[model samples]
Target: MRDPNFSHKQMSAPDRLPTRGLPSNSVTPSGRNGVSSRGGEINERIADRIVRVQWDLTNLKDFWKVHSSPHRSERLAEYLNAELKVLEWMPFQAYDQNERVDYLLLKNFLRNQLSEVHRDAELDSKVLAFLGGFFPLRMANMIEARQRVDDLYHKKAAESLVECTKRIILVKELIVSEKETAEPIVALRATKNLEEFKGHWQEWYNFYDGYDPLFSYWISEPYPKLQKALQDLIDTIKKVCLGLETEDEDTIVGEPIGRSGILEALDTEVIPYTPEELISIAQKEYAWCETEMEKAGHALGFQHWRSALEHVKDLYVEPGKQPSLVRDLTREATAYIRKHDSATVPPVCAETIQTFMMSPKAQKMNPFFLGGDEIIVSYPTQTMSHEQKLMSLRGNNIHFARATVFHEMIPGHHLHMHYMARHRPYRQIFETPFCIEGWAFYWEMVLWDSPSWQKTPENRIGMLFWRMHRCARIIFSLKYHLGEMTAEECVELLIDMVGHERATAEGEVRRSVMGDYGPLYQAGYMLGGLQLYALRQEVVENGDWSEKEFHDTFLKANQLNIELFRALILGEELDKDYKSQWKFYEEIKRD
Candidate 1:
């Protein structure tokens, strides 16, 4: 049986307040002297506070060190000041959940401890760490979200590529200390000693975190029709710089960068048919989810509906009552699955159990099972109200259902969790979200494109579906996060570029910008793809290479961003440009 989804909107303001739950004597910070806090100076007091935060984080890491209970992880989020939201809108019962606290709560917490906290940098770092843990899963969701949309305008893709280029320029400007630019990265970099890398890490996080939303907002909310406009502007600039007919100019000028040219390009792109027919096609595709769900023995009557409603409300309203509900619900679902023989347990879940059957190594590792439901994947449909339910479902797709299973459960994310369970020594580093998420994100394309899944026409279609989603994700992310593309423009782009409907496109746009960890969805893929591609190229160029060798080495290595991975494989050092630069950060210097 698919796992039940949870909702956080059911949580009241009072329930979310972090009152009386933490250990009262939690390692008191000894920091003082506003100057030390404001600037990047490392006085004893500031050092002590940083150490305490790290220690507290380490404690949480230790708690999940060798265990396979997503429930326990959910509980950890509560202590860490966060809530979870799961969406159930598809027949495949795809998982989509957001685990995060209110931005206001975090903002206030930072304000209260302003003197000792490098607020922006510190907050960004923590958020990055949190999101990084689930980076790949989120990226898959974003890509799926984009593909489900029915319209396709290539301009959206162009917008994303341009945004990435612009950011590259922005980082280059920062490295060179260009005038009129903020210096968050530089401030963050100031703390990069062995004892202070975490602090320095926050500085880099601060720079990207603040910039991401502003960039996303331009594409998403206020002016939601920016994609075509931005694309046209870019095309116009390209035309002006390197006359339209010149190949050399084309290479030098690159993609479009402005609005007018993109708008004109969008206008000229002909729609294949009526919008109503397009919507109908999308609806039919989405209905497969319901069919699949029923086949898995999901009873979608009033009883299940009522129970779902009651269960979600109680999750936060009566936190005291959650354990019983969770237990009873999980038991009932597990029993139902056993009786029906419809719910297929994944390979990784089985592998985890086998490994933990307790060989001495297994005992030392203490591996265990984490139910599929506990990770809390929110579906695209749950956010809709009664009137919008049909429309919402119509916008959903199963393109990433298989990819999700691979990335979240098998040789990808679940593997990361298994490693965390088996290897307690690296728990502190292991808990870092970027490493976890990055690895999973890296696999979405890797697994989808693998020959194992491409054996038949049906399989090929599935692969294309996934590829389409990835393309859409790239389009939506760039348009929303960087190019300032709007939902309508994004929808039009989807129609023109990938053939997804407008309703689906709008949903993708909303999720890309509005949801927690949304930015990471795009950033993770960009970062992960860059890393995987660069590594494969490095080995291929350096020696007689094999995909099997690359795959095995990648799977066994530290799941951190490209920097650490490149360092291990190629013997190169990298700067914080790990977040950007497509090649290893060291490669940027070489270039």
Candidate 2:
């Protein structure tokens, strides 16, 4: 479990959205981007277009009617602003909201193309191709765009993941609906969207579910209000879908009305920690880490990082001699963080490393030091203080520093993300979350055996207790998602397992309800670990393979589902046979 390559201050996984057609930062009025001329007109136009699309997309018939009109496709494209409010607002609510929004966006986009085909066969054929070709691209584009944006603005980026979850849910629902249906037309469309959608959804759920570890950290928000809003929305949606009458106000779903309570709680909750109290906790935590490193000795660094580096280096260079890997490692590590930072990097030569070192990527790295890479940490704004929010990498360094370096940097996420990011074509960004996050979580235990951390029984006990806490978290996700656990039960489990004296754990549960079927958080790591282990054995039996090569191959695959990766790596093609079979039905419909 000892990983030496881990660095502190690492950030979380990248966004899976594409940045194409995004207005340059300069065009933004915030001045964060360099394109600002005609800002007022552009803003107004963008706003107007978003409202129109949102309005038109609500009715399935309207969505299809308008989009299918001749000469309207280009007009529709002109109004589609990916950076507008519609895109931004969709991520903050329940799964249903996400579903409605994503489906509408896609449905409308597809709906616009009706004129291209008139016959049933033609319609079916075109729809299948459009869903197959366009939806995956759209999903990937959205994920990539958000990833870049998150790199620039950490807290906002972190908060945006709620939206990412929404988008994934959208794709997942579409995939399920497409695959299971008996209808020929529906099946054809399913053939188009379901493959990539299922692949990406499984990847997100299985791997990246636990990216924001500090989601367990307490903030000043009232957990109840957000829960109520989410519940109310769900109830209302169910009623409407069932054809039951609802109050007039209920029709306007997914609005952040009455959110002031959540906001107020964020601004004023009193956990009552003195500055001295935090520093005292930090001292205890820091000492604990030191003890772990000592026990782990060289294996901590080598296993987590250097060994892996040597392996990959062996692919090109001499086996035991030191290579220039460290310099490239440092540069790559820093650039990863610097790219993910929302705040500007100043040109001060004196503290350049230290300056970029405060990024979320760096904070995530603090957990992995003996492993020798940097961590990348990220969380929503409320968990971060205002100053920290503004400066991004600012505030109490020791807190994020410890978390990032120990958890994500050296032995952790940085190594994980770097490998994954490099391996695939751009589309793979949307593919790998569970593996990325699961690997980081696995190392949390690995560090406990480090020499520097085992000095005190309290440190050992604390780390053990924390692991138990994480275990509880995983169980909660499984039970909740599988429909066996209720929100109340989830809350009770958190209190019992993690000593939920802090509101952070409760907040995490509340957020979980808004994403996927349940808490598939730990499912990624637990399941992914099993998958990786099995795959490793299979490869070993087939051909002699190094762990380093496996690790590199794993990471470079860009967070693809282990199953999908297995197929691709084992020299199997993507399942075009099933899709080809699906195309037959489309051809049948067309003729």
Which ranges of candidate 1 are over 4 A from the true structure?
1-400, 420-438, 501-503, 518-520, 540-559, 573-591
Q: Indicate the worst ten consecutive residues by lDDT in candidate 2.
A: 582-591
Per residue, candidate 2 scores C-alpha lDDT tens digits across 448-497 of 43343322332333343344445555566545544456656876876654
* Whole-model Cα lDDT of every candidate shown, in order: 0.34, 0.36
Quality of model 1 by C-alpha lDDT:
0.34
lDDT for predicted candidate 2 compared with the true structure: 0.36
- Cα RMSD (angstroms) for every candidate in the order listed: 25.2, 24.0
Which stretches in model 2 have alpha-carbon errors above 4 Å?
Answer: 1-404, 445-459, 515-519, 533-543, 567-591
lDDT, residue 434, model 1: 37
TM-score of each: 0.36, 0.34
What lDDT tens digits, residue by residue, belong to model 1 across residues 335-378?
Answer: 43234332233345443322111122221111111222133222
